[model samples]
Target: MDLILIRHPAVNIDAGICYGATDVPLLCDAAESARILGERLLALNVPPVKGGWHTSPLSRCRLLAEAIGHVHVDARLQELNFGSWEKRRWDGLDRALLDTWAADLDHSRAHGGESVAQLALRVSSWIDEISRDGRPVHAITHAGVIRVLTGQLLGVPRANVIQWPLDFGAIVWLRRVRGEWLLVRWNA
Candidate 1:
């Protein structure tokens, strides 16, 4: 099975603010980003999947998915919820809370939302459903979701996966062939 994963366009929020799971707007025109991405895919010889785009319910992803093609919005594809930290500035948040989260990054729900393990479970469930059909899948989602999915497929250390520099609007193409997961077209 093949999967084409694309991160949504840049958001309008400031760098210091924590805004996951808070539906945010894109910084640029979704259609424009779609146009450019479509061109890039063509250059990479990645043909469009007939089933259309499966996207996170957040507008950041949904809008771009609509711009590119038909969209199937799925809540499971959403970014990890930050709960009370939705729109708060990271620096202003309680230091204790921050430390608590850092202390156990994978298990802590210090912010009252999903832990890394929870995110992995939901994402894996979603992907497993797709893989069952043995069809090429195309999706637009958040970096957090991408990180989880890539880490699960590639057998990378979770800490290192957390450090992957997936730029906004970047495309990641992966495929599972002959019982092996292959990373292809990551920098696209």
Candidate 2:
């Protein structure tokens, strides 16, 4: 089985603004992104996307998904919920609270949002829900969701997973062999 995880295209939001659950619009509309991305994906030496075409319900992801093909919008594929911090600038957020949240990587809801554990559970369920056929499982989702799913597949520690830089519109590829998932490519 192959899984292809693509981060949604860039958004129009300002830098440092905290947004996850909030539905942020893309800098380029879905069709435009798809037009550009289609060429890019075709150039890459990755497997052709087959089977499920899944995406987060956020327009940033859904739009791109729709442009490419039929889409399955699943809330579980959404970015981590920022709760009350939905649109606040990161610099404007409370420092102590940020530290408090950072202190507990597993369970803290600091900055008022879903815990990492909750995200793991949500992403895990999505993983379980997908078909495991040999075809690539394509999904357009948030960086947080992709990170969690990658961590789960590769057994990367939760705390370390967050440190991996994932760029907007990046593509991560993983393949399963002998019932084990291995990283084929990252941030492509």
Candidate 3:
């Protein structure tokens, strides 16, 4: 089975703001990026919104999904809730908090937000439920969600997952072979 994950395109949020799960609109450039990504998926026989299992619950995810065409909104696939950090500027955050979070992502949480482990549990459960179907599935979600899922699949530390660097609207395909999950392609 193949699980295709794609991050939502750029949002219309402010330049330095953190908009985790804030339901922000996509930027003009994001619309263009989504169109291009959709074209590429079509070329790959995976055309966006093609009546398969392509699913997402994010507003931006839904927009992109509908643009390509067969997507369903699945709450289980929603981005991690940032709580108080939503719609705030990252630049204004306390440096001490930032440093501590950077040092230990497992226990880190934005003020009134979720920890890395909390997100991992959610993403892991969503992946498990989908994996049980044993069919190909495409998911349009947030970068943080993707990072957690990729970390789980690859057995990498959560803190280092950001080092993988997922570009806006990029695709990462994970396939399970003989009961072992492996990275088939990343940032496609």
Candidate 4:
């Protein structure tokens, strides 16, 4: 089965900030972004593929999901909960805190936020759910979620989940062949 992982459209979070999972609204260019995404999905030409759909609870993701036609608002697929750090500009954060968190991402929590392990649990759960369906599924989510999902599939050794690069609106395809996972292709 083919699984298409689409990152949410570009968001004008003022200075292109790292909003994480704070439920920010999408930018005005959302429609254009969605159109481009739709075109790309059509280009994939997967067998048994239907219209595009799937997204997190965030507006940016949800709007894009609907733009492509059908959508499913799955909370388990939501971006990592940044907790107290939500909406705070990265520049305003304390360097020491960021560094400490970076060193121990699996154990660190941003104020009321969840640890890396906690986020992984949710991601893992989502993966398990999707793997069971055994169909061509399209998912639109945050960059961090993409990284974590890819890292887990690749069996990477990073705990921070930032090792894989996932830009806004990027698309990555993963598939399972004979019970083995494979990275099909990725778009920048």
Candidate 5:
């Protein structure tokens, strides 16, 4: 089974804002971004609309998914909930709270948002459910969701998963072979 996770295009929000699960709009034209991404996927021998296509409900992802073609919208694919911090500039957030969360990435919910462990649980469950069918899948989701899924699939250390920086419109490929998940390509 193969899974291709594509992060949405750059959002319209400011660079330093924390907008996870905020349903923000795209900064780039969705159609153009999809076209470029489609070409790249084709070059890699990955069909742009292949198999069970899915997208996060947020417009940043959903708009691209619609531009690409048919896709099932799922809330499970949404980014980590940032709670009160949504739309707030990261630099303006309380430094002490940020440090506390950074100190315990897995357990801390310092922003009053979902903890790293909680996000991992939901993403892992989605992975499990989808992998059961042994079908190829393309998902238009967020960076946080992609990070959690990658960490769960690759057995990445919880604290270090954030280091795997993914740019807007990045694509990650994974495969499940003989009941084991393996990373095929990342940030493509």
Candidate 6:
């Protein structure tokens, strides 16, 4: 089964703000971004998935999904919950708390949000459920969700996954064959 994960386009929020799971709006024109993404996918020989596309319930993702075509919204695909950090600039947060979270990448909840392990578990569950159907799937979601899903699929450690920089509207492609997942393309 082929899995295509697309990150939402640039958001309207100012730079450096922690807007995870904040349900923000997109910065780019949804239709135009979708059109460009569609062309890029076509160039890569990626056709629409056999099953319909899936999107996070957030408008940032939902609008792009709608512009592309039909979609089913799933809350599980939503961005990691930043809790108290939502809408706050990262640099403005307590340095000690940030350090503590960084030290314990998998288990820390210093930001009062979902831990890396928690996000990974949920994303893994979604991958497991979708893989059972053996149909190609496309999901429009956040960078954090995509990172977690990709890390889970590739067996990458949580700390290492953070090194992967997924740009706005980036696409990551994966395929599951005989119970093993393989990365086909990334950041397309």
Best by lDDT: 1
List model 1 lDDT by residue over 1-188, tens digit each: 88999999899889989988999899999999999989988888885687889999999999999998888899999999988988999999999999999888789999998898899999999998888887889999999999889999999867788888989988999989988889987848
lDDT of 5: 0.87
Candidate 3: misplaced stretches above 4 Å?
29-35, 43-54
lDDT by residue for model 6 (13-117), tens? 899999998988899899999899999999988756665789999999999999988888888899999879999999999999999988997889998999978
Question: lDDT per residue, candidate 2, 115-137, as tens digits?
Answer: 98999999999888784446678
lDDT of 4: 0.76
Worst 10 residues of 2 by lDDT: 128-137
* lDDT for each candidate structure: 0.90, 0.88, 0.76, 0.76, 0.87, 0.88
lDDT of each residue in 62-156, candidate 4, tens digit only = 88877767777887778877777778877888788888788788878854687777877898898888667687888889877777777788677
User: How do the residues 65-174 of candidate 5 rate in per-residue lDDT, one tens digit apiece?
Assistant: 99988888888898998888899999999999999988998889998989988888888878778777777989999988998888888888866777898999999998
Model 6's alpha-carbon lDDT is: 0.88
Q: In candidate 6, residue 178 scores what lDDT?
A: 83
Question: lDDT value for candidate 3?
Answer: 0.76
What are the models' TM-scores?
Answer: 0.96, 0.96, 0.87, 0.89, 0.95, 0.96
RMSD of 6: 1.1
Better of 1 and 3 by TM-score: 1
For residue 56, what is the lDDT in candidate 4? 89
Task: For residue 152, give model 1's deviation from the true position in Å.
Answer: 0.5
Q: Residue 68 CA error for candidate 1 (Å)? A: 1.1
TM-score of model 1 vs. true structure: 0.96
Per-structure clash totals for the candidates? 0, 0, 3, 0, 0, 0
Better of 5 and 6 by lDDT: 6
Estimate, for each residue in 99-186, the C-alpha lDDT of model 3 and write its tens digit. 8777777777846687778888878888887778677878888888888889898888877886787888888888888987898778
